[model samples]
Target: MKKMMITALSVVMAFSLAACGTKSAPDSAAPQTGGATPAPDKKEVTLKVGATAAPHAEILNSIKAKLKEQGVNLEVKEFTDYVQPNVQVFEKQLDANFFQHTPYLEQFNKDKSMNLVTVTGVHIEPFGGYSQKIKKIDELKDGATVAIPSDPSNGGRALALLEKNNLIKLKEGVGVKGTVRDVLENKKNLKFKELEAAMLPRTLGEVDLALINTNYALEAKLVPTKDALFIESNDSPYVNILVSRPDNKDSEAMQKLAKALTSEDVKKFIDEKYKGAVVPAFK
Candidate 1:
């Protein structure tokens, strides 16, 4: 009896020891607490932009590094003519373009039945009148032929500049919508020849005076501040802008581009590199 009781007690003690030796599984039912939430995934973006060669592309290239830092890859396609850039953007071949102003964009949208919008104003290339035959506006001979851009948007700008400098008089409130027919007075009997904007620079010797866009003037190695007879006022409404489709106007990539283009570095770059040829429109 005594041996039986001792064996039973030993078995009970052995089971208790084994139970203590065995480790308990973690409390799987308990909620985890005090840990950081994972960060959101950032989407990588590549923005393909179309721009003019001299100032527009140059300016876009200047911000390539900055955009990269913001996780955007910039692909700048150089365009010599203005039409293709907008067409490409409208067709979704490019993300955005930086070669035109608000007035031109407005006319283009109307003419093409598309919906493109401005992201931001980048710079102003003043419209000016250039001449090799005449030294001043007053020296223009009677019946002297003056060449202007044939496109309605730019032709209107040329006429506005001519009117501003007293070279001619446009009818009241005719502003940017003015045409050659809108001329109220032609005091110098200036014969008007409307030509393509790009051809105006080459026709400098042929015409008494050529009203030229500052971009083409620069391309022809003509400095508006020095060579132009008169230039658009600093307050001119024709400030060039960064443009995109209306739907993409608020996209992350477009917003980043607009921010980078109007950044202090870009402003400084324009002021220094182009001198006064391209004026910053941000301020």
Candidate 2:
């Protein structure tokens, strides 16, 4: 019995010595490039995702499973507001973000001189017109008050959408970014008021027609396919993007995420899910 007890103690001490100060395989939940090695069969990505709570996060949810198949462990982080996500990305707290379009992203970079770039276009959310007071565009009376996003980019978006619906006409080469001042013609004789993008949807009842951004409009229970009087074109270059630091624009995990979000499966998902409210921009 004394010999057996001594042998058991020897085995336990050997195991303890092996574990002390000995690092196991690298965490499969994060990247370890200094002294640690990647796990043999798994790739770890402490990828941070910054996005809106609904569709952006909802879209990410659909791709999480597909991304995992490529051995990338993604952490999809949700942001309720728009500005913080970009700041988080610039601060190196996030791996990639998906919430804004090319024009907005360009504006963000130009405004802050941050080095953010899009990996790929994921979805195009249409800028739309909606109203509870008026049933449809044709129902809008002459001299009716219309509210639109006051910001440059989205105000231009609203104008383009208005132009597309033949409610207004723009000067040649005015482009989709044209504003209320750029309206070479306004046939409907409607009055225009510029309000912040986030406020337009909530002010719907006060105006005959209100141009609400897709995301906010959706939050207000407005469905582009049914509720919107008009929606932007499907290929709206303003399509929201999946973005990362310029340095990791082509990283393996980033590539996997970009591809997964734009994959055929996702395309079908958006088509069937948003019902034309959200258009998959990638062909």
All candidates: CA RMSD in angstroms? 7.2, 8.6
Q: Estimate each model's TM-score.
A: 0.84, 0.79
What lDDT does each candidate get?
0.90, 0.83
Superposition error at 33 for model 1 (Å): 18
lDDT (10s digit) by residue, model 2, range 104-139: 888778888888988998888988888888776788
How well is each residue in 37-67 modelled by candidate 1, as lDDT tens digits?
A: 5678687799999987878898999999989
What are the runs in model 1 whose C-alpha is more than 4 Å off? Answer: 1-43
Q: What TM-score does prediction 2 earn?
A: 0.79
lDDT of 2: 0.83
